[model samples]
Every structure is written in structure tokens, then in C-alpha cells.
Target: MPHKLSEIISWPEQREKAKTYFDSYGWPDNRNEAWKYTSLAHLKEGKFTASSDSAPIDSAQVIDSAAQLEGFYVEISGSAVQLPPQDALPNGISITDITADDNARAAAFTHLADNHLLPALSAMHQTSAIAIDIEKTDSAAPLPAVILNLTGSNKEGACYPFVIVRVHKGAEARIAEIHSSHAGLSCPLMVYEVADDAKLQHIRLQAEASYTTHLGLNQMQMGKNSQINSFAISMGGALSRLETHSLFLGSDAELAQSAIYLGRDRQHHDITSFVAHEIRDCASRQLIRGVLDDKARGVFQGKVRVAPDAQKTDGQQMSRALLLSRDAEADAKPELEIFADDVVCSHGATVGELDENLMFYLKSRGIAEEDARNMLIDAFLVDTLDEIEDPDFAAFMTSQINRWSLARR
Candidate 1:
């Protein structure tokens, strides 16, 4: 059952504004360049409803599953969950519910009002938002990691979860955001603001069930001399798309992003990113890898724009895919638009299959053909996993890849 727009907890004015925006644009189809390859036919026909109602959850089960994981856990069953008390946090870290501050809510609404369909819908139907603020001093002490677990229900409706992260000047923090779902739809929006001289490490893992559909957007704003390192691992969902929009608001900002995606058995995974170097002396790098098996499909579309005034920009992007089966498909579209003459920009893409010579070499060494293939696949993904700064999180991601490989075998 779909809930009325009025049932969502948004300011009347903002809701109306978002509704007007959504009505004008409506849902994008193949005609939309960004969504040309991915189809939304099932979603459009399903008429999915957005709800804040919490489903029955086994807290113990969730806790046990994450007991070995390192970090402070913030769990979301269907909607956002409560965080620990302020006093329990570190000296410079604060987690505040967005609803507590009307100004924050309004600012968030404004930032997402004109976004794509999923983000606009998220702004209109989001029930709760959590803001994490980090303030680092010159003490050089390592800040604690924050983990967000977004779990979806088996119901047929959709749930929208929103998160806001701010790294104050001179602060350094690591955040791990994970998404797991059952048999429904999920649309999540995350915003990050990195102040001057701040450093943020973000690790995202999307491991939803095969029957789920996930559409997620991550919006980032980087200030002068700020740095953001992002590593994402996508291994689940029937139809999953993760889009990132990064804007360098000030000069000397840097961004390093890498992603690994695995698709099998008719699954579809898409990773799209648009990065803007709006100022001078900014640098950005992106590396994407995909592993497809059976009849699965993978897509990577990345674009880097250097403004006319944005001189001294260094940007590079690379996309590579490995197809395990003849029916598997991989598509890569790497583009660069440079308006400045003093910039260094490059983009490359490659799609290929397993090397038969390597397979034969391993087989001659007394390894089974399946074992050799799995070993080669794992070796191919090791570089991407190495990009992660956290050893624990990298280990976790590696485990996911191994699990996928073993299951397919």
C-alpha cells in the first residue's frame, strides 16, 4: 500500500517544491542518457510505496552478524536507528538527528531538491536523517570509525534512508557504510561535506539480496586542500546502481575513488560518476573494476570536467572488466571534457576475458581448472582491495569477493 505524500515527515513547502520538481521531470527512461542502459520498467510498473513503518527485526541476529566487525555500529532495520549518547562519543565527534535542527533539515532539503528522480523522491519521502560531525585537532590521534548498516525488509514497498557527514577543518575520520536488503526496493541518499584541510576515508559495501533493487546517490563537496578517499564494493542486488557526484568547491582539493563490482546469474550492476574540477590546482583519480559471470551485465560510465578557469588540474580515470562466461557483458564509457588548456586529463577502458594461457599454466601445476580460475579472479581483484586504507574493512571486502567466487563455483 502506498502512503500519501502528506504522511512523510517533510516541511510542507519543501514537499510541495519536491513534488513540483518530480512532476516536471517524472521518472527517467531509456531516453535519459544517464539511464540508457539500465531499465526501470519493473519499478515504474510496480508503483512502489514509501513508508517509515519499522518491520520486526531480530536485534540479536544483526548484532551477532556484526560482532566480529570493527567499528561503532549504527543499524537501520527499515528506517534510521538511534545512535549512542553524545557523551559516549569521542571528544570531537557528534552524531545528531537531523530533525533536531530545523536549519539542517532545510539545508539538506535544498541540496537534494533538484537532484535525479531517486534523490528527489528521497528528499520528499525521507522519514529521518542523521548527521555526523567530526572536528579534529592537531593532536594526531586517530579517530574512531563509524559504520552504518542499512537493512531492508522483505516487504514489497520501498524505504528511503538519508545520511549527512561533515568533516570539520583539520579533522580526519574513516566511515564505513554498508547496505543489505531482503526482497524489496531501497533508495538511499548520502551527503558529505569536507572542510578545508580535512581528510575523510569512506568505504561503501552494497551486498543486497538477489531479489532486491537498489538505487543510491552519494553527493560530496570538498573544500580547499581537503581530501576524500572512497572505495566501494558491489556484489549483490538484482538491479543495482550507485551514482556519485563530486564537486571541488575550492582549490587544491583531491579525490581518490576506486570500486569493484561482481555480477552473476542475470544480475545487473552499474557504477556512474561525474566529477567537476571547478577550481585550480585540483586533482582526481578514479579506477573501476568489474567481474561478470553467467549472463550478468556490468556498466561503468565516468566523466571528468575541468572548468575553463580551473587550470593546473590533474585527472585520470580507468575502467576494466573481466567476463567469465561468453554470455556475460561489460560496457565502459570513460569521458573527459576539458575547458582549460593547462590540465592533464586521461581516460581509458578495457573489456576482456580470463587468460587461457594463465589457466593452463595453473592447471599444469596440479591445480584444478575451477580452482585456477578462482585464483586468477581473486588475483585480478587484489589491487582494488589494496586501495582501501583500513585493513579490517579491506579484509571484509575480500571475504565478500571470495564468498561470491565460491558460490559461483
Candidate 2:
């Protein structure tokens, strides 16, 4: 039986609009270019409803490794939102839970003006959101992490969670996106706005149960001279699709994105991103690596666009997947649409199994076959973590990967 939508949280106008769109256009399928690798034909028949109650979870009992690290955290289970106390936050930063105030809700929701399918579908469910704002700071040490943990229902239901992060001029912030176990039918959206001279370091860890389904999106808007460095690890969830959309509204901005994924036992993971350089002198790079075992499958679709007037724009993307078993599958599609005469953009993708020569060499050195394979796998994934600037975040991600590799053995 379908549960009821949460009554405590409501966004009447946007919910109605999303409902109308669903009634007319209907949900998209593989026919849509954006969803070519992932299909939603089965989701249309799901009996899940928006969650109707709040769940309070103990931080220590959470599954995601990021939640274990020290930080000011926000915990959300279903429609409930728990923000860090104001006194606990730094002087120049503030995070707040959304209320019924029309002006406040309207202002924070501007990021979804031209919404995507996942956000629109989330709107149909009871919506819960939080706003994060940071001002310029002169602290010598790096700012502490802000962990946003989204947990699913203990019962059978769905969850819709939203977050917005704003970095003021000349400021910087570090954020960690952590999802707990069993994020059932979850559709979450996050928006990051970086002003001129601002910076943001974002790291995400998705370690949910095998029965979970997670559909998520991250939108990035960059201004002149701003920068964003982000990394993510996807190792859980039965079906997971994460899409990142980046737009450069000003000149001289930089973006660096890197990710690692591990799939086993018939799991499905999809990562898709779109980066558009609408202005001049912007540079963006993306690096993705994954390891698959058993009958698991992985997909990566990356597209970069440069406008005619956007001179001196440079973008690069590369994706490589290492298959651990014959039954595992990997698919990649990389695209570049450049209308500018002076811009440079390129993309490349490759899928292959572990190196037999390396394995043979390791075995000749007296290492067991299983030990040699694990050693080679560790080396293949270790370099990816070098791209992460934050040591704590890197270690957290690596710890989870090691655990997963052990389980695979």
C-alpha cells in the first residue's frame, strides 16, 4: 500500500505545477538523451508515496562514513530537517531550516526556476529544504566540513530532500554529502552558487543498502574568478543515478571534478554531467574511474558545451572503468559541442578488464592470485584520491572502498 505524503511540509504552488507536468508530459524514459543510459519504465509502476513522518537517527549508527567525521551536521529523515545550532556555526556562516514564510521560501527556491525532472518529481512529494550562506572569512585554518546526511524511511515510502549553498564574494566552504542506508525512491537536488573570488570544496559519499534507489542532481553556478573542487564515491544502492549540471555565468572561473565508484552483485550506477561555458576564460576538468564485479553495470555520460562568444574556454573529461569479472558491463558516452572559434574542449572514455600482465607479474613474485588482484585494484584506485585536496575526505572515501573490496573478496 502507498503511504501518505508528509503533511507537515508543503510547497503548494510548485507541487501543483509538478503534478500538472506529470499529468501531461509524463515521466521520461531512455528515449530522452539525458536519460539514454538509464530507464524509468519501471518507476512509473512503483507504489511508493512521499514519506509521512520524521525519523531521528543516531549519528554513530549511520552507515555513510562521512557522518563519522567531526563537523557541523544536518540530519534529514523524510521531511524532517535538523540544522546545526547557530552558536555552533562560524560567525560569518548561517544555515537555516525553511519555514512557512512566503518570501524566504520564494527566495531560496529561485535555483529551481527551470527545474529538472528529478526536482520536479521531488516537488510532488512533501518537500524539505535548507539554506546555507557564507561570507568572506580570514581564518588561517581551513573551515570545518558541513555534513548533510539524507536518510530514508524505515518503512516503505519515498523521500524528497533539497539543499542550497551560497558562497559569498571572497569566501570559502567545505561540504560533505552523506546518504544513510536505504534511501528508497529518493530524489534529492542540491544547488551551489559561488560568487566572484569564492571557492567551494564538495565531497559526497553514497553508501546505502542494496535495496535502495537514489536519483540525485547537483547544480553549480559560477561567477568570475571563482573555483569549485568536488569529488564523490558511489559504492551502494541497487540503482543509482547522479547528474551534475554546471554553468559558468562569468569569466576566469575553474572547476575540477573527480569521482570513484565500486559496484558488485548486480548493482547499477550511472553518472552523467553537463558543463556549459557561457562566458570567457573558464576551465573545467572531470576524471571518473570505477571498478565493477559480478554482474554489476556502470554508465558515464559527460557533455561539455562552449558558446561562440566564450573565448579561451578550456574543458576536458575522461572516464575509465575497470571490470573485475567477465559478466560486469561498462558504458560511456562523451560529447563536446563547441561553437567558439578559440575554445578548446575534449572528452575520452575507455572500458577494460584488469591487466593480465600485471597480475602475472605479481603472482610470479609469490603473491596469491586473490592477493595480487586486490593489490592491483588498490593501485588502480589510489591515484584517483590524489585529486582530493582534503585529506580527511580522501581518507574517508578510501576507508569505505577498502571495506567494499574486502567484501568483494
Candidate 3:
């Protein structure tokens, strides 16, 4: 019965040694190394409770029913957590709502909940919270719209959560981490930290509910000429996993990793990223894309590491997949490990489908073979909305990917 959130929280022995190594290595059934390819033993054999002690949800109607990531400034509707004071943020900003007075934000949420596991299962089920701090200012604006609303509460196993974000030192920010799931078993976690010569732009949007289960973990620290541009977009979930861990730690640091996952039916989407350059002349770039239909299942794992003084390190990794059925399932793994030697690492992966001569040349231009396969699935999700260099957040993520490909055609 050891599951009242691992028996009343007293962890902090590095999360009780990673929850006693996942309780004697249980939940990774398809062989470890990041659960091989999505298997949490069917969500721990479904005894999945703990998500609804109800009440306290109305961050202005969950930011007016979510799905709006145009410009940010904290507007969550359900599980209520909204803000705008501090002379209405934005000039050398700092916004805190760490679940309001949890004994004065409980030491900044126990310094990111002491060795995380879904942010210590969302601070032992505290529900809604926010702590975004961004310093450094010498001009330039247009980077402030931190809206996080993980809605849920249609009651079936209700886990709607939040996290810790801090971006300081020579800071420049652009964040829009949005998620909306109004139907059961939903889980949400977001943790971010980017300091030193900082310039961060992270936009992760997962439009939820398909028997939702989203687990997101993003932790980054890159000093020196620091810069990070991360973008993740998963159109809906059933079992979505986004785990990104990065560390470059000073010296010409920079990273631009992108993602896009679109799944249908038995949806299971996974996008994993791990980038560690350690030090000295660092630069990294990773691109990931996926789209699976019908018997849906997609996973992309990317790893790029160049330590050993990371001399002149320049790393690149790519993953591409598009299977439109034939019992859809696509997996791509890109890896690169360079122990310096004046590093210049590379990685590649691809899985094919669609493009039957560009769908018979867009059905000979008459365009009605399901409208030329929904305009080639909206031009393959428009290269993840042009990596969102913010033209109004890439035209609102291209109108939410053409309204989720016209609601999956």
C-alpha cells in the first residue's frame, strides 16, 4: 500500500534515493534507459488515484478556457493562479505566486522540491502555483506572458499541477508554457532555471485530453554567453512525455532544440532530450518532429554530449517521423557523444510515410483527396511552426496547427 504519494513525503535524501530507485525498479518495463519506449507499466497498472481534493480552481476560468498562447502574462482559469502586479511586470520582471503564502513560498518550494520526481509529485499535490523570476535589463522588451493553466478536474483521477521557473543574470525571457486538459487523470510538471548572461525562450504547449497523462520536466543551466531557445508542441495526449535536461555551464553557451508531436487514437507520444556540453565554446541544435495516426505511437529520443573541456563544441541532432497509419508507430533515436578533440558532433534519424509522390502531386492540384491529405498534414506541421521565432508566437502556433489538422480531418 506504499502509495499515499510514497507514504507521506519525508524524502530529501535525494528524493529518498530517487524514490528508492523507483521502488526497486518497477515502472520501467520495456528495459530502462528512459523506459526504452514509453511503458510505465501501463501507468503503474492503473491504481492511479490522487488528483482531486477538489476546489480552488478559477484562475479566471482557467484563463478563459485556455488554447490561447498569443502573448503571455499569467492567465490561468481553473486551478486558479493569476497575476499582474509589480507595476504589471515586464521591465526587469519578477512574478511570484508560489501557491501564495505556503509559509512564504516554503523556501522557494523547497528549492525546486528537493531532487524532483514530477516536482515531488507536484509538491505533494499542492495543485496550482507559479514562481517566475527574470532579471537583467538594459532595453528590449516583448518577452513576458507566463500563462500556465493545467485545468483538468472533470474528476476521473484529477492531477492538475505546476512548477518552478527562475531566469536571472543578463536576462531576456519569452515563455508561454500552456496546457489545457479538462478531463481526468491529467498530470502536469514544469521546472525551469536559466541564469548567467541569460536569454531564454521556452514555449511548450500540449493541448490536452485524450485520457490525458502528460509528464514534462525541463531543467537547464547555461552561463557564459548563455542562450536557449526551446519549443515543444504536442497536439493532445493519452500518454505524453516530454523530458528535457540541459547543462552547458558557461563559455559561449547556446542551444536551440525544437519539437512537435501529433498523434491519433491510441495516442502515446514521447519526446526526450538531453544536452550537456559541460564547458568551453559550446553550441547545440536539435530538431524533432513526429505525426502518427490511427494506432498511434510516436517516440523521439535525442542526446548530445560533448564534455572533456568541450573544446569548440558544436553539436547537432535530428529526428523525423511521419507515419499516417499501417497501424501507425514511429520511433527515432539520435545520439552523439564527443569527448572533445575539438568537437563537432552530429546525429541523424528518420522514419518515413506519406509523400506518395507528394500525395499524387496534391491530387493533381484539384485538391480533394481529403483536401490533398489536409494540405500534406498542414505542410508536416509547418516545420514545428517555424521554430517559433515569435511572429506572434509563430502566428499562434499556426492557428494551433490548423486547429489540430482540422480536428484530425
Candidate 4:
């Protein structure tokens, strides 16, 4: 892993700009509205160095796991590895190191320049960056999925990896990013650009070790008539925070986002998102669900903003959490900032425990207590999982939920 100041100096202009921003507003504290529920005390206390330690990983096992997924797979073990040659990939798709092309590097820097603290830190210390581009083709067949796997080492240092994805006009694609790690800190950044008339299905899975700390940022921009559907599953890490920021850059764009998080033991999970409607007739919807047990904590903070000129915009957001134990905690904040008079926007949040009556009913039907509890938990989250369009991916997520529930019992 590279040091922040050293990595920033590698790019002079970005270094100066990032230095100014850091000096002005340092790391966010509890007073910051966006980070009130999440504290960086643990991260600041650790002595995090940058090192690419591959000895902890079994390359053969990583390859075997990627083979089970449906897509063109690229594995990043502290650095980019197991990337297929361009000739091996499909005609319309290309995945390459961002530093290989000067233009792409510049574009990535520009895209990341205006982001907040975590993203800025990721841009400054990123050890490697990947760029995925999909071009519009004459073929009628849907493009295959592209999977990016990020794995961290056993060291107590921070790992920085960045990804940029571009879907050309009139093209359609699917992407899955999986993050699995050991005892360390991980900060990942990603940017997605969907062109006019294009469609993208993006999925992210975070299943790091219980001793790891993870912070991630995802930024998206949608063009006219573009559609983006995103699904995220968070089930691991001692303390994890995932933030998403989306902008509708043109009229008639649409975005749908769904997320499920499971936290147990003394773990903490935070999911925060901000969606901006910058143009007229754009639509956005979000649903987030969390299950926490055994003194765990879960937090959801979501906000939707519509510009004054963005008339006819439609936006909705909902967050719900289930606490399985008396000591568990759940916090939710849903907000809407609408400046357009003709826009339709709404936000709601609910935090509660499982329905005891329903659990008793299941138990009366000959189900064991643990089984009954798991059944009710599944029923609570099935609606959101059903929102996924891909049946295979949905089934995988369901299995993960089942596994977590079984362990909790």
C-alpha cells in the first residue's frame, strides 16, 4: 500500500487540490450530518501502511471461485491480477488498467476530484485502477456480465482500489463487484457512466472478515433515457460504511436501487445514499433493509434532491430495519429536498422487531423456534430480494441470507 501524501504527489495537480481540500475540512467528525452515525475513531487509531501482500491469498482458490460466477471475471488481490487478455473478451467489452491510458487516467481524476473525503482519499492512495468500457454494437443479444473481485491481505494497512465503468450509447450491460477481505482496512471507489438509451445492472457484495474495517464510495451519472438498477448486499466487517451518490444528467433517465445488510455480534453497518434529479422527467427509487442481532448496530441515511428546474421528477425512498435482539440497535434517516413544484417525491423509514404473533403462529404449525425466527426474517427481506431481475443472483443472495441467519441461531 502507498502512503497518502506520497501517492498524491505522484500526480502534482491533484496533489495540490487534494491538499487544499484536506487542510480546509480534514476528516469528518460526529458533527458532520453525513457522518453523525459513523465514527472514524477506529481508523484513526490504527497504523495503516500500504503493502501488496499476496502471500495470504490462494490464487487457485480465487480462480475457482470466479469460475462459478457468470461473467468475464477480473480478480484484484491487492493489485490487478488474473485479468484476461483483450482478445479473449467479447467484442464490445474491454477491461484494462486505467494507468495504461493517459486519457482514461485524466478522466478518472476529473470524475473523482469533486467527491467527499473517502473518495478523495481513495483517489490519492489508490494502488491500482481498472477501467471497463462497453461500446454499442449492432448485435441484438444482451452483453454478458463483468465481475470484478477485490481481496485484501492480512496486514493491518489500508488498501485502495478504484474502478471506472462506461456504457456506450444504446448498449446494455451487467456488472458485479465482490469485496472479500481479511483483517485490514479497505477503501474502494467506483464511478459509473450510463450513456443515452443504455441500461446497466450493477451489483455489489461486501463480505469481509469480522475483524476488517471497510469504507466505500460509488458515484453514478445517467444520460437521457438511460436506466440503472443497482443491488447491494452487506453481511461482513466489524465496521463498514458504504455511500452512493447518483446524478441524473439528462431528462427521462431512471434509477432503481435496493440494498440488504446483515450484522451480528458487535458489528456495525452503515448504508448512506444521495440521489440528485438535475433534469426534468427523471425518476429514482430506493429501498433499504437491515437485520441486526447480538448487540450489533445498523444505520441507514438516504436523501433525494430535485433541482428547481427539474419539473415532473419522480422520487421515492424507504428504509426498514429488523432487530433480532434486545441489545441490537437500528437508526434510520430518510429525507427529501425538492425544489420543483411539479415533482412527486416521498421518503419514509421504519425500525422494528419481528412480529411475535407471526412467530408464534409459525411455531404452532410445528416449526422449531429457530426455524420460525429464520422464516419470518426471510419473509421480511424477500420482497427486496425479489426486486432483483436476475434469478441466479437473487438465489445467491438468498443463500447468503440463509447462511447468516443459521449462524445467528
Per-candidate clashes come to 0, 0, 10, 2
Best by lDDT: 1
Candidate 2 wrong stretches, greater than 4 Å: 1-13, 47-64, 109-115
CA lDDT scores, all candidates in order: 0.79, 0.78, 0.68, 0.78
* Candidate 4 structure quality by residue, lDDT tens digits, 35-67: 899777655555442221112233344345445
lDDT of 1 by residue, 15-123 (tens): 6777887888777788888888887777777644222121322434434544556667776666647687788887888988775565676666444425467667776
lDDT measured at residue 211 in model 2 versus the true structure, 0 to 100: 62
Query: Which 10-residue window of candidate 3 scores lowest in summed lDDT?
Result: 1-10
Looking at candidate 2, what is the lDDT of residue 188?
Answer: 78
Screening candidate 3 with a backbone cut-off below 3 angstroms (N, C-alpha, C), the clashing residue pairs are 57-79, 59-77, 59-80, 61-77, 62-77, 62-78, 63-76, 63-77, 72-145, 73-145
TM-score of each: 0.90, 0.90, 0.32, 0.91
- Least lDDT summed over 10 consecutive residues: which range in candidate 2? 1-10
TM-score of 4: 0.91
- lDDT of prediction 3: 0.68
Candidate 1 clashes between residue pairs 3 or more apart in a chain or in different chains = none
lDDT of 2 at 364: 98
lDDT of 1 at 364: 99
Residues 31-55, model 2: lDDT tens digits: 7777777766657766432221112
